[model samples]
Target: MLLDELVVTADAVASTRSRLAKVDALAELLRRLEPDEIAPAIGFLVGKPRQGRVGVGWRSVGAAMGQPADAATVTVAELDAMLDRLAATSGAGSAGGRSHELRELTARATEREQGFIARVLLGEMRTGALEGVLTDAIARAADRPGPVVRRAATLSGDLGETARLALTATEAELEAVGLVVGRPVLPMLAATASSAAAALETTGEASVEYKLDGARIQAHRVGDDVRIFTRNLADVTHRLPEVVEVVRGLPVHDVILDGETLSLDEDGVPRPFQETMSRFGADAARATLLHPWFFDVLHVDGRDLLDEPLATRLAELERIAAAYRIPGEVTTDPEVAERVSREALAAGQEGVVVKAIGSTYAAGRRGSSWIKVKPVHTYDLVVLACEWGSGRRTGWLSNLHLGALDPTGEFGEPGGYVMVGKTFKGLTDALLKWQTEYFPQIEQRRTENTVWVEPTTVVEIAIDGVQASTRYPGGIALRFARVKRYRDDKRPEEADTIQTLRGLLRM
Candidate 1:
């Protein structure tokens, strides 16, 4: 298929607020793609290239811009091949080689295609075709059941492959996609609650586990060989050898465990989140050790526990990894839930996650079966822009323009962010220095005082609450917003939504 065709579809998807219309437009596009073109096309549509980061930044993209082709001639396969070459370019002179390749690739594209390529390279595609909507589109195009496609995608952890199977293979073949021991599945997500009692009301007879402020990890072990993956499914087995050893020591021969890992100080208190993340990003393991705390077991000795109730999974987790299980209690009483929350906070943990005992694991979905309650209101929001600091903090990027996700475009552009508020508070000198150096690297555009960046940085912000306001496009502004920390583990799409902030008005 021509690249322009896909660009046109993406434009169509972005120009509307109705999810059905977006899905229909994407489904129409999907129906026209060849089997081999499906994955790359999907990647471009969602702003996540299959090649991942191709070492191309905004400046690189800008440097490569030239006169566009008069007509569209670039094919999807050709674009995919170009991305492959760009990803492979690395060495002493790789920068020049990448620049040459990008220029050549862009030179072959029409004006609209050039813009599409730029957005895709910058990871700033603002189209409304989120994964869920595109998944529905895949189902629509393939004439398959939505649940079947969704299950296959969730289990396989590859939406592109799921689309391929749903469109080209038989339904039975698609249904055969099961949870593999080695492949990491998407982690289960949770909703937010104000307090333990509120969370308990949503999840009756729950397992209230400590919500640790740590990086999420999923470990898969087959005998002595164990693999560790981050919540984003990036394998970090080599970086987290201690975690591998812990999983290897488990009683079971084969298992899949979901948990968190954090470095602890001498007092057994968890270290700052950044300290723990530093270990994950290092070339060699740091001196600080990260202790793995398993909360749920998904697979054990060949039995798939994902379909099993939390009670069953907890039983399996206790039997196999009791020593590493996170502290929690099984109770229906609101008072007991509150006590657990208090205990967790006193232990320097985040709060408590109340999980329904009878609920099965719903991978990649934030259902009411699990609710996280924190004493303070905090949200993961995106950094939309940064402004220059003044006075004593001059020459640094101090004030952050924060935005919340608007996946459905209820308040703004679909699949874009809605600016909620700005903050220069809670940032240490080190953070300010880092921002000054980093924001320029991803800078999309700039004014005299503000640097508008791609909405890709996820920062945890603590807020008193939100109130109705016309100062922002979302009809609400954050009250007393301050940065808690930078969540390097999360993606822009994972940030909390505008609708979520608006919901706080009701409180």
Candidate 2:
């Protein structure tokens, strides 16, 4: 209920690694929560406001603790004073009044309260800390044994929802929110069915559809309003004005659609992935190339397709999509999926996604019932001091020098030396455009011929074979490893580590 309560728990959790100590700490923290703290805690774990189609980033703790949003616009000292005022108010008497008063204050605060808003929302209230660190601390404070929190984390769908349930419900209630016996808050998935004969073996009568090759896009439509988001949940409504406009005109009152967005070439065939991605970013030119291809409908006129089996949902979807004569989505027989996949691949499209006859829509998850079988490639390599590039890479040294990790004397920051290859490829033209614009943010310096860099980028190279080399480190070289592409989602530490390189070399 008060700021000190949460702070005390955080402090106690951070102080220990002992099991008994953590359980004791959690017990002490629990005493302070007063039940009502569950709402704010839920809000905290969710990273944004009330559940929405696409979420905003985490808001500050100061705001959550009842400080006016405007309070964030004030001086650090002023913010501190506001925190102090709430703390004192909580102790004095009228907790509800303080909450009400804080809400009123937030309404009247300055329009330009940027720092304060960031500080409060991100819980940047304490330095040298992050959500993981705090959650870990809470488990420790609870006096639980090693990884008690992590164990709890894995049991529930995710940490935030788990934490919220833990604070508000019984253990049975907690279990109720899980997949085993619970009604999932998000989407439900259908079990994978085999061939129609195999389907008869499993369910007597299974439903199936021809697998499709395209980007997975989930469309959520509420009333007259429609929102489009990616699998990872980032909103892409603006990039898809043509799409949202199409979905809106559908006769359904409210619905959720699952499908992909791709581009077709002159022959009316799907385009390459690189060409499709170009139509989404801010600097994108008009995308006459990219087009929407709807496959299945998840919801329709006041109905949710989550728990229903695939066969039933498909029948409903066909009625809805056909009613609107949706142009992009094409329904086909399951037996023809492999042939269709080859057709799409020949057209430069990704592989296909197979669906069963009685499948359910799986939201916020990578459901097994709906599997994506893409042709993926991987490589392992050691690190070498990187070379600097030009323009955007003029500073902070962006390029990398790759090597094979030596087993006997593996890599240790310039330890082994190999010269297998160098590459400035794998990046799309859109990515190149971004690097050119934002490279200055990380640049360190520049030289006449060789540029020095930050050594942060990592990439995969798809090559023919391995070969022995005199110039490169590790005594061997990648025969024709070319830059496949920059792995933007990974961190440098996670880059093919030295150990991974040894495995590749062994092969």
Candidate 3:
């Protein structure tokens, strides 16, 4: 996997206009790799590292390519320079020596060094294809199951690894895909847990304990050395020394806890969301910005509680925080929970996340496992079909044609969904490419280009208010049904119905 190899693949994927063809080509190229080769392969395709979740902007790529005004132009020397720099530090020493090291890598016919070096400098890799589509393509190429590919992807946090392993796999693989699957992820910051009922019914359990919010953090501690990672998994332990101090002082030594980092104002209320996000990745200024309130511990000692229920984890979390008592806070009462959550809201916090005592930690997956009940009426709709978007969406599949389940099997169309409106936000060009290709599969074409899907996706849609429209197939249409995200876990069967829409409208 030399730089040239990746460049060739990048050129192929980016230049190909047909989404299905792009997917097929990528799948074939990826299918030839070993399990260990996937990450670098993706890095090559994207022209960056697969490890970090960072996105590389064309501006930076342009800088690397020395294409001052040109946005799309990508070059190998810009990529080579990045690899040379990484080799200088992580490989050989000094600029002159680094070139020699890269030359040696080329001579050995190794793409690892070149890929890693490029990743180190490029920050991210960009290709027209997306993670999910690539996962599907990998599944098809490797002849493995889709769930297996998905599991590997979740565990590794790298889809390229999934693509790589698809080439050749064994019964006992390199990484166990279990832990990452059911790991708890924040659904969406809520205003409050309005009911113990919402938590229990949605999670299908008893004794839902409400957790307070400051900042959402997934803190991982390996040993005596403690490192705190944010929701996105970028380690910021150094930034929040005070938090590290709290974590270090805890009774439990080795564990991965999910909690929030809050910055209290002089009046003891939470700061604004913008103020909190500003504290992210800030090492020196973090002392003045934050503190942690541990709500649950997913893993402790040698045991992994990814399979353990949520209630059990929270008990241990409360006990540990209580003994250490460094910036400690925990609660089981819904009333107190409501107060804190409301306090958070008053102090500009988003809301509280309530968990069933028995819920499992589901990572990268949402829907009912941890139900988000907000004060507003919101529905997670899918981008069923799309129109060529406007302005910024020019030349891109710009406007997303939104839909809900055509549950009634109405108008001689049953078991599929229909279009209601189109949205232009929350999409990148790659996402558009995906829609253009896949959206047509379930597409019920009544007209040219503006196709329909089976409503197999879900998005968290909100409106300032709802409107009444009998003409629209949903009977009532959303005033503004914008896409929040393309939730992969949710199936089309879960899409909002005409009844649900009308219910909200009536309310």
Cα deviation at 385, candidate 2, in Å, is 5.4
Please give, for residues 317-417, the per-residue lDDT of candidate 2 as tens digits: 67767543223222344445545555544555444445545555554434555543334436644333345544233333335456543334554444343
Candidate 2 versus the native: TM-score? 0.45
Instruction: Compute each candidate's TM-score over C-alphas.
Output: 0.77, 0.45, 0.57
Question: By lDDT, is 1 or 2 better?
Answer: 1
lDDT of 1 at 258: 97
What local distance difference test score does each model get? 0.91, 0.48, 0.56
List runs of model 1 lying over 4 Å from the truth: 377-507
lDDT leaderboard ranking: 1, 3, 2
lDDT of 3 at 464: 31
Q: Which stretches of candidate 3 lie over 4 Å from their true place?
A: 1-26, 33-37, 44-48, 51-130, 145-149, 161-169, 175-200, 206-214, 285-287, 323-348, 375-423, 426-507
lDDT string, candidate 1, 1-507, tens digits: 999999889888876768999999999999999999999988888888889889989899999989999989999999899999999989999999999998988998999899899999998887878889999999999999999998898888788889999999999999999999999988999999999999999888999999997899999999898999889787889999889989998888999999999989999997755577777778775899999999999999989999999999999999988999999999999999999999998887889999999999898778999999876799999999999975346688999999999999887789999999999989998999999999999999999999999999999999867767778999888877999999999999999999999987654
Q: How accurate locally is residue 273 in candidate 2, as Cα lDDT from 0 to 100? A: 42
Better of 2 and 3 by lDDT: 3
